[model samples]
Target: MTARVGVVTFPGSLDDRDAARAVRIAGAEPVALWHDDADLKGVDAVVLPGGFSYGDYLRCGAIARFAPIMTELVPAAASGNLPVLGICNGFQILCESHLLPGALTRNRSLHFINRDQVLRIEAAGTAWTNRYTPGQEILVVLKSGEGNYVADPATLDELEATGRIVARYAGAAPNGSQRDIAGVANEHGNVVGLMPHPEHAVEALTGPSTDGLGFFTSLLAHLAEGSPLAGAPTG
Candidate 1:
């Protein structure tokens, strides 16, 4: 059976369609989920696509964190029963919801940064990152205003020690994220949040490299294994 991946659309989400298209191109059925709905519609996994949901009012993802869908997502993700990938604004929401550690602050440069960038996979043992080998570098697009990731020093130390830093910038830090981090995942490896936009990088003809397609493909392969959906690294 084809894996079904859900792409959620909140009121001001700009890249939901792109996310769904990427899922389709990656050989999965794309399910359209609404922010107001709590049901996941039985998807194997979920992607919180990039965008300024609710106009980025109080903060990038502050308002969207309380969206009805997140109520279900929070518990499911915490239980390690679901795999959740949050990109850009979605990453902001994951932080706001405390599903992932660290907060995304305004770029230190104080401006929106958009570019195709390289990232090193620091932890391949995550639901969303299994397609990448540890230490491998891949290109993805990073675009956002508030993309600076921050956490307490102790927390940062723990994350690094636990190998939770899923990816890091390969060159100059684009948003001044701590330690040049581009992404991190939960202990169970089912939840991940990243500053870069992988969904946008899936199509080679449209933009930069197609390195992002691995994320979606990795999830499908994970489900096929018939193992618990988190914590294993992909080859």
Candidate 2:
């Protein structure tokens, strides 16, 4: 059977359908998972697409973190049994859920920036990034107001030391994210949070380039390999 990837839809989500399309383009079945639904439907992987969930109340993704679906997603992802990819607002949700370290704060400009951004793949070993080559640059869409990622100094150092920093801004970071960090992965590498919208870049007709397809394809490759954990750096 082909791999099944779940794309979650929380209230106010805007890119869930785009993510599902990207999954289908990557040769996987896209399963629609609602925020209030507690069951995951046994999907091999999951994608949290971008949008202002719960109207970005309190903070981006703060309310969505408490959604019933997360009740099942958090533990499964924590145990390294489920692979989760959070994009843009989805990235904020992951941080709010504590599935990944650091918080995405307002951009230093305090303005919503939307543009095609270049990102350098910093950790190609991660489950969502394994199809990429380390240091390779890919262009994807980035549209957000609160996209600055911040963490305690120690946590930042730990993430860097352990090869968990998944991607970095290729040029000067538009949001002023610390250390130009754009994405990161959990210890086991089954979970990743990216501030860019890869789903929006999977098709040439719509996106800047087809670079974003690798993120979804990587997960399919991992599922096929049947690895309990992925993303270990290779020499």
Candidate 3:
């Protein structure tokens, strides 16, 4: 069966369509989901694509966190009954939703930074990352004004110690994210969030590279297993 991946379209979402297309490119059925819709249309997975949701009002992703869809998403995702991937502003939403840890603050540069960013896969066991080996590098588009990620020392330590760090900037960190962190997964590795936009890079002709294809494919592989998720990973 073709895994159905839902791409949410919030009030100001910019990449929901792109995410849906990437899912299709990865051989999964892309389902368009509305932010206000409580139902997820039975999608096997969900992607909160990037954009300035709620006009980035009251702070990025702050208002969108309480959307009706998230009421259901938060619990299902937290319980590991569903897998979720949040990109860019969506990452901010996940953080705001408490689905993921830490926070995405204003870029240290205080300017909107847009460019092709290089990131190294640090945890390949996540449902969204299994297509790559640890330490594998890939390029994805990153465009945001508030992209710096910050967390308490203890949380950062736990994330690193628990092997939940999914990806990190390959070189000098852009946006000044702590420890060069670019992405991370939850305890179950079923939920993930990142500052870069993978769906934007799933195609070579239009995007920087096809490196982002792995994220969507990885989830498909995980679902096809027909078993509960279980994997051992090292930090």
Candidate 4:
């Protein structure tokens, strides 16, 4: 039974297909989920690929957070019974959904920054990051205008103390995220989100090195541990 990973496609999503392809390349079955449909289709995990969901209205993921599908996803994720990986716009959704801490704000540069970004894995205990060893560095494409991650100083301290800071920009803070954070996970380690796109970097023949493959592969190892996510099926 191959692991089934669901990729949700919002109206403005641009990389849903790429995300599904990356899941397939990582040896899992990719399941297509719709933004309005609340059915998860028995997937072992879910991925919210990057894009300008709802035309980035009001804020990036603010409006998309209220999508009908998120109605189920929210509770499922909050119960810590589901594994979710939110990339770029999806990251914004996670934050807006309150599944993750902090908010992705406008970059200090105030321009859409597109570049191959290097990131350091700060923690690897999350379901989506188990394949990466702490301190490991990998490059992936980062493109967004409102990509800076911010939170109150106290909240930031709590995250650090709890080891919730999963990854950070390796060198220059490309988007000026606080402390150069590129990704983070919930306390239970089931929910994870990142601004850089690992799916885009998964195929060497297509773009960069295959360093991003680990993100999807990591999910396989994550759910193989017999998590309690309902309807989950895995190889």
Model-by-model lDDT, in order? 0.88, 0.93, 0.91, 0.89
lDDT of 2 at 219: 95
Candidate 1 regions exceeding 4 Å error are: 229-235
Summing lDDT over every window of 10 consecutive residues in candidate 4, give the lowest-scoring window: 226-235
Ranking by TM-score: 2, 3, 1, 4
TM-score of every model?
0.96, 0.98, 0.97, 0.95
Q: Quick one: how many clashes does candidate 4 have?
A: 1
**How far out, in Å, is residue 2 in model 2?**
1.1
What lDDT tens digits, residue by residue, belong to model 1 across residues 35-121? 999999988899999999999999989999999999888998889889899999999999999899899999999999988899999
Ranked by lDDT, the better of candidates 1 and 3 is: 3
Instruction: State residue 136's C-alpha deviation in candidate 1, in Å.
Output: 0.8
RMSD of each: 1.6, 1.1, 1.2, 3.8
Give the per-residue lDDT of model 2 (tens digit) for 40-77.
99998999999999999999999999999999999999
Answer with 1 or 2, whichever has the higher lDDT. 2
Worst 10 residues of 2 by lDDT: 226-235
Two-way TM-score contest, 1 vs 3, winner: 3
Which of 2 and 3 is the better model by lDDT? 2
Residue 82's lDDT within candidate 3 is 95
What is the C-alpha lDDT profile of model 4 across 122-187, one tens digit per residue?
877778877888889998889889999999999899788878888899987888899999998887
